[model samples]
Each structure stands twice: as structure tokens, then as C-alpha cells.
Target: MTSKFYEDTKVIVKDKLFEHGWGILKDLYLGETPLASIAQKSFETATGTKLATVYLLDLFKENIVAIHGEYQSQATNVLSTCNVFIKENSTANEVSNCVDDFLKNANHYIDESFSRRLFLKYGY
Candidate 1:
């Protein structure tokens, strides 16, 4: 079953993100958002990691994704970190940056993963 955040909230965010013309971004998300993780070629997952979120904007009708957080295992750098609460009243710019950063991170991970495979198969 999909999370309620996914069913009800993606549209609002997709619209907002699109309207703002954000190519990709990382923004404040409530503690509960329907998001997925964009795994690295050799990525890992665990509890408390805010991965990436897949979005389909209304206007574009194409899916995009945004990611944040990091991977840490066996007590690595990210294992003990906490989600920085986007300030209760953050400025518009701060929020925008977060969203943008997230999108860029997600896209980079995704693009790199697919491109390598495509190149291997077809020599791009």
C-alpha cells in the first residue's frame, strides 16, 4: 500500500515545485512524506534515512525525483546523524535550496547509474 502522503501530497508539491520552475531541489518536508530512496550503484538502506522522492508534475506529466540524506553502515558518518528539522519558519529561499539540492542529488545518482549501464551495453 502506498503511503497517504504519496496519494494526497505529491500533487501539491509537484505543482509547487513546477510552478517555481525548480529544475531540481530539496525542500522542507514534514517528518512523514511519501518518498523513496535513489540507490547508488552499490547503495544501502536502513531505518531513519530520508532517501529520495519520485514526483510527476501535473504540467510536465513526466516523473522526476529528489533525494537527501546519506548512506552509512556499520557506524559510518551518516549512521548517527539526525534529520535537521527545517526551521519551523524557514525563509522561502532556504526551502527552495533544500528542494533543489535534493533533486540534483537524486538526478545525479539516477543519471550516473543508467548511463553507465547504457554505455556498457551500447558504448555511448
Candidate 2:
């Protein structure tokens, strides 16, 4: 069964990351830019804030790890695929393709009986 929370989080993260444009998307997947930076940028862009609080940053970091763990649990091949994209000198198109495949194969379900988490932790 698909999880509404997981699906919602996925859409939210993707939309936020792509909000300004697709310019940073490749940088993120390539490891040239960190997800934290993107998260902060997204927050600032959405809220017009000059700075994000440490609490928000910590929450984002924690939820990001939790979300990754959930994704890994749902798709066993996710880490290996991500490793390939990150560790290898893959072209932009190759990385995009790999990410697309990974997303396509992921099972968007959460163990709802346990902690119900979202990537950003709070809505923008």
C-alpha cells in the first residue's frame, strides 16, 4: 500500500528543490551541492527570510536521514544505485536517468504504525 505521507513528502521535497529552477538539481545529485543548502534555499525562497533557525536546520537534517532510511527500507537497491551516482563520475544525463529509475522503483509506503515523518518536518 502506498503511503499518503511518503507521497506527500516526496512531492513537497521535489517541488521545493525545483522551485527556482532545475539548475541546482544536477548539482545536488552530483554531490557538488549539499541537500542542506537546498533546504535552506527553499525555506528562504518560500518565506523570504534571510536566515533559517538552527532548530529548523536540525529538523530538516534529521527528517532527511529518516526519509532516506524509509526509502532504503522500501527499496533495497536504492543505496547501491545512489552510491553509483554519487561515487562515480557520471554525466548529468546519466545521473538524471539513474535518479529517475530509482524513483520509479521505490515503494512509496511508510511503516505508519511507527514514527510518521516528513522530509521537511514542517510545511513551507
Candidate 3:
């Protein structure tokens, strides 16, 4: 990802995670999140991608499992995979591989803290 996009993604992620910040993503990186985002732990979009699954819920911070995982895109496969991942998923490392892939995609400016935790598993 380019530095501009990386910076944008960082701002978006932080705003979504912070209290009284200015972000409004419904769920964590929901959709494809750019295969690259999951692959390397970041995203690159001059604007936005249809596959990107980021949205805001509210202004106040909320607790949610970081849903950024790799799985088949189809609904059936996705549902089944989600069941398996949620049931089998353990600590933050469960998604580190995915995150590593996300960074490898080459987002030029990832916030130093973006990949610190697995998804949104950190305490609020």
C-alpha cells in the first residue's frame, strides 16, 4: 500500500478504535479488506475498494473480535470458516499470519501500532 493510503488506513483504524474520535465503521475490516490488507496487515487504496469491509458503529469505543481473517468469499464457506475460526481461534497470534500477509502487501505507512494485536482483541 502507498504511504497515503497507509496513513489513511491508520487514521481510519485509530478513529474507529478510539473514544470520541471521528470514525464510523460498522464492523471491523469486514469484506475483502483488500486481500493485501489481510495478507500483509494493511491496505492500499487511493480511495476505497468495494471489497473493503470497514465501517463504524458509534462514537464511543466498543468491544468486538477483530473479524479480519482469511476464508473463502462465498457465504457458505465464509459462514463455516467463521464458525471454525471462532471456535478454534485462541490468542492474538491466531491471526498474526494473516496480519503478516497484510503488511507484506506493502502499505507504505502503517501505524506502528496497527499490527500489535490480533484484530480488535485488545481491551478497551
- Candidate 3's residue-wise lDDT over 4-85, tens digit each? 3233343434443233222233333436342223211123222221132222122112222233432222232221222111
Deviation of model 1 at 11, angstroms: 8.6
lDDT of each: 0.37, 0.29, 0.28
Model 3 ranges with Cα > 4 A deviation = 1-24, 28-87, 106-124
**Candidates in order: C-alpha RMSD to true structure:** 12.5, 15.0, 16.3
lDDT for position 12 in model 2: 40
Per-residue alpha-carbon lDDT of candidate 1 for residues 1-124, written as tens digits (9 for 90 to 100)? 3333333334343444465443333433436432333222233222222233333221212222222344333334232222222332445465456556554554444334433335445654
**Total clashing pairs in model 3:** 18
Clashes of each: 8, 0, 18
Better of 1 and 2 by TM-score: 1
Error of 2 at 32 (Å): 13
Q: Residue 76 of candidate 3: its Cα lDDT?
A: 24
Q: Evaluate residue 92 in candidate 2 and report its C-alpha lDDT on the 0 to 100 scale.
A: 41
